[model samples]
Target: MEKLEEQIAHLTRAVDDLSDIVARQEGEIVTLNRRVHMLMQREGEREASSGGAVVLGDEKPPHY
Candidate 1:
């Protein structure tokens, strides 16, 4: 019974540690998602203002 209690305690501690790690990673993911959204919006606006040019190499822009 004591060994069982010890094992349960260790499992609980491990689960709590994993939960904290998941929470921290969730926050980081949210931050990274926001940054990616902002970058995408900026790139879209830049492309629109540039007349929808192709992103591929050697392709002339629509203005050509």
Candidate 2:
């Protein structure tokens, strides 16, 4: 019975630790999603101003 109690205690602690990790991840995901949304908005504005041409800086010129 004592062994079973000890196992239960350990499992409870593990569950609590995992719950904290999940909570932290959820917060981080929210922050990252917000940042992505803002970036997309900015890109959309830039594209509109650039006459719908998507200019990727990595592209080489015709001379290349």
Candidate 3:
């Protein structure tokens, strides 16, 4: 019975540690998600102002 109690205590400690880690990671993820959202919004506005040009090539010389 004492051994069982010791095992349970060990498992409980591990669970608590993991829970704290997960909570911290979740907070960081939320922050990163917000930053990405803001950047995407800015990019969208820039694209809209640029008339949504899809061409991606260098301009040819006047002789061409």
* Stretches of candidate 2 exceeding 4 Å from the true structure: 54-64
For model 2, state the Cα shift of residue 46 in Å.
0.6
lDDT, candidate 2, equals 0.94
lDDT of 2 at 14: 100
lDDT of 2 by residue, 1-64 (tens): 9999999999999999999999999999999999999999998998899997758776688798
Local distance difference test, candidate 3: 0.92
Using TM-score as the measure, the top candidate is 2
lDDT against the true structure, per candidate, is: 0.95, 0.94, 0.92
* TM-score for each of the candidates: 0.82, 0.84, 0.76
Q: Please provide, for model 3 over 1-64, each residue's C-alpha lDDT reduced to its tens digit, 9 standing for 90 to 100.
A: 9999999999999999999999999999999999999999998998799897753565566697
Sort order, lDDT high to low? 1, 2, 3
> What is candidate 2's TM-score against the reference?
0.84
Which residue pairs show collisions in model 1?
none
Q: Show pairs that collide, candidate 2.
A: none
Candidate 1, which ten residues in sequence have the lowest lDDT sum?
A: 52-61
Each candidate's clash count:
0, 0, 0
